[model samples]
Target: MSSENQELRKVGLKVTLPRVKILNLLDQSDERHMSAEDVYKALLEAGEEVGLATVYRVLTQFEQAGLVERHNFDGGHSVFELDSGEHHDHMVCTETGQVFEFHNDEIESLQKKVADELGFELTGHNLVLYGKPKVN
Candidate 1:
């Protein structure tokens, strides 16, 4: 079985053409984050007969299955990316709308400490820092 098929089976989702196609797109995309409209446009450009609504539905399903992670950036738009099994945070460039991924042990430890001080277990957390790129 193909990797996509195995992923679908592992998530208890029946393998389907649209699911496979979307998963493949996400897996192969150069941009880690993509919106539903972006995905729909890519499908159209690729000559796939997928509908916009179907893209939205499939993306939501993937998010629920933990195959993808969704983020609502400061732009008030949501983007999806494949969950690569590593925890990281995001930094968005406000000027160019670029996204960058970063991991910091200090930040993670501080978050844990804050949660512990509050007597709450940190189940999960998402940190998004927005800034402009340094210009020469």
Candidate 2:
């Protein structure tokens, strides 16, 4: 069995063509985060006949199954990326709508310290920064 099949089975999702194709697309794409329209366009470019609604359905299913994560950025934009099982914050470019993932130990420590000072144990956090590219 393929790795995609194994992953689906592990996630308690029955393996199907659309699911496998979508999973492969997500894994192979250069852009980590993609909207359903982006996925549909890519599928069309690849000569796949998957419908937009089907892409949305499959992406939602993947999100529910913990196979992917959905991030809603500013301007009503939403994107999905494979859940790589790592904790990372995001930076979105306001001009390009691009997403960047990063982790900073100092930032993490500061957050923890702030939470501690507030008399709260930080259980979870989602941090997103937005800015446009600066002209040199």
Candidate 3:
């Protein structure tokens, strides 16, 4: 087992084939954000026998353990992504619900200034920009 798997096991979660498979899939996906149905479909496409409920259960556990982060975008559905351990913000495609991650030093400085003016410490924040793609 890999170090990540060992850490998960140490957290009291059983080492199982399904959990490992799901974790690997999330670890390798490009988009990083996947819904329960997305994971279930991937498992079926990969010929895995895990059920949708199991996928959801494991994702919930991962979220509670800080191994994953879940987001509810403008679309009603939820999406889960691996925790990158870096602080950044999100930009969501309003038309398609696609997400992009970005960080800006200017924005961070402005946020600090605003917080200082308000006499508050800027611990953390979530900035999600929702908009349609520009036409060519």
My TM-score estimates for the predictions, one after another, are 0.96, 0.95, 0.91
Where model 3 places Cα greater than 4 Å from the true spot, the runs are 10-12
lDDT of 2 by residue, 1-136 (tens): 9999999999999999999999999999999999999999999999999999999999999999999999999979679999999999999999888889999999999999999999999998999999989899
Model 3 Cα lDDT, one tens digit per residue, 53-78: 99999999989988888988887888
- Supply the global lDDT for candidate 3: 0.88
Tell how far residue 2 is off in model 1, in angstroms: 1.2
Cα lDDT of candidate 2 equals 0.95
Ranking by TM-score: 1, 2, 3
Report, for every candidate in turn, its global Cα lDDT versus the true structure.
0.95, 0.95, 0.88
Pick by TM-score: 1 or 3, better one: 1
Ranking by lDDT: 1, 2, 3
Off by over 4 Å in 2: none
Clashing residue pairs found in predicted model 1: none
